[model samples]
Target: MFFSVVENKSMVNQSGKTGKQLKMTSYLAQEVRLARRHEEILSQRSVLLQQMETYLGDKKTKKTWQTQAADAAHKRNAALLNDIEAAEKKLQERVYLLPHPDTVKLETLYWASVEESLPKWEEFLLGRAETPIGFKKMKSAKWNISYPEEDSQK
Candidate 1:
């Protein structure tokens, strides 16, 4: 469900942004929206199925028309299931077309940034420094605190 967009060599050229980039961006943006839509469709299908089950399981004496209604419900459910399957397949295809991010470079840069900022954070925590500019002071309750157990061997 996590969508990351990295420039694919095939999709980009030396000059500027290409149509493929725009298409990829559009698809990435649509991915979440589409996923939510799929979930809604699934929910609708489930409700329909539950209703059908309830109707068919009723203890009342079966009327001639009840059988026809049940058959129609079954047909509609089958059609919905088919649509869901097709949508899932299409989603998979769209995901397959998405370019994967360069995790190694990303991780390296992330760690470098963290390393650069660690000293400032440590100084602030130690009370020797004021709250760093551009950062708000968070409540103590917002922090997760854990203490290491003392070694019994010691």
Candidate 2:
């Protein structure tokens, strides 16, 4: 006796055993690559935005900064000019105050005359034997060292 069994082709089930698994892995790898590329592009854009913001911030302050600098320079120049004018005026005043030798000699002679001609009554009234004579008081006291004609000639 001989026996035979015929197999049915429809009895096999794939259930994603081999070929589908390879395809899914390949798709996951492609997705990861795309995600990394997008992250790199977003980072570059953020860096460019920060640089543009810095440039724009400086542009907004341009006019006021230049005006302040010009004002400071003008003030410095004016102060320097005032200091130079003051120094020139001081030099001129010093030159005017300098006493000539002839004027000093005449002044000495006038004071000597007043010292010699002091009366006893005037000395007693003032309570001091001698007093320092200034130029203003000497002129008012009729003390003269030169002739009227000679002074008029000068």
Candidate 3:
């Protein structure tokens, strides 16, 4: 798994699964919200349809107009509902060791990249020993750290 020491930055840990569950939870929440929005829009359209039917009633005209509006609303509703179902399917397909969304604080969007690279990270380390690297194998490496620029910079 991986972790972040600050906001909007993430580093993969041993298995690159650090914020995986949190990332999934965030994505699922987004899908669910979109689904709910669709449901709300459908509800609103239904209400408008009923109102129009009541207003345009002249017996024969009532049947024709109501049918048209209902048909359109039905199609749109079906599409929106399908989106919800697809989102749910994705949510169900995934499995994570630590599925805690409660822990997400600073790094919200950053974890998305971390989750994306997790499988590759695991594959990369597959040939290595199961246990962590021994001190004997340690080596020094160069580093180039970045910093946020101040507004005072022209």
Candidate 4:
């Protein structure tokens, strides 16, 4: 979840530690991509196994041909399983290389402090002031604001 928060380029740029933030973002993205690839490989293996099972179960197929097909399918599945294991190991390695969550949180807080020290920082603050208490709770806030271009005719 913290990784997802850091994926925003604006946030990373505002952090004042652009290099480190970008590096972390890149590694997190790579990890997510690898995870998706692992899932895809697993799905492929599942489909292959299912097809092989169906073929082998067909009553019309000759016994000798079925035996040969089964052997080939077994080898294919074994190779796929090996691939899955390799991917799992790589994923684990990536996870191990990531910084501790608490460290990341501290870094994030530091970035927030940096932002808070900048001019006009109050304009970026969330929550409404007119509430029974100090401020009304907000479900979400948008940090990246864009203004429309002014027309030359105006």
- Estimate TM-scores for all models: 0.27, 0.37, 0.27, 0.31
Who is ahead in lDDT, 1 or 3?
1
**lDDT of model number 2:** 0.71
Per-candidate RMSD, Å: 48.1, 15.0, 51.9, 50.7
Estimate, for each residue in 35-140, the C-alpha lDDT of model 2 and write its tens digit.
Answer: 9998998998999899888877777677678888899999999999999999999989987897778998999999888677555336645876555343233564
Q: Can you write out model 3's per-residue Cα lDDT over 1-154, one digit (the tens) per residue?
A: 2434552146335665545656766889999999999999999999999988777676668789889999999999999999999988777765354456765543665698678766656654796434333224334443544456743463
**What would the per-residue lDDT of candidate 1 be over residues 1-154, giving only the tens digit for each residue?**
2234543444555667665776767888899899999999999999999998888767343665688789999999999999999999999998788545676578878999989988878888898888777698789987966556545445
Q: With candidate 3 superimposed using the best TM-score fit, by how many Å does residue 54's alpha carbon deviate from the native? A: 1.0
Give the distance in Å from residue 86's predicted Cα in candidate 2 to where it truly belongs: 3.2
**For candidate 3, what is the TM-score?**
0.27
Summed backbone clashes in each candidate are 0, 0, 6, 0
> What is each predicted model's overall lDDT from 0 to 1?
0.79, 0.71, 0.70, 0.75
Best to worst by TM-score, what's the order?
Answer: 2, 4, 3, 1
List where candidate 2 sits over 4 angstroms from the true fold: 1-28, 55-67, 100-154
In the range 7-93, model 4's lDDT, one tens digit per residue, is 554454654765556787899999999999999999999999999888877744678778999999999999999999999999999
TM-score of model 4 (CA atoms): 0.31
Q: Cα miss at 2, model 4 (Å)?
A: 99
Which pairs clash in the backbone of model 2? Answer: none
Tell me the spans in candidate 4 whose CA falls farther than 4 Å from its real position: 1-61, 111-154
Most lDDT-accurate candidate:
1
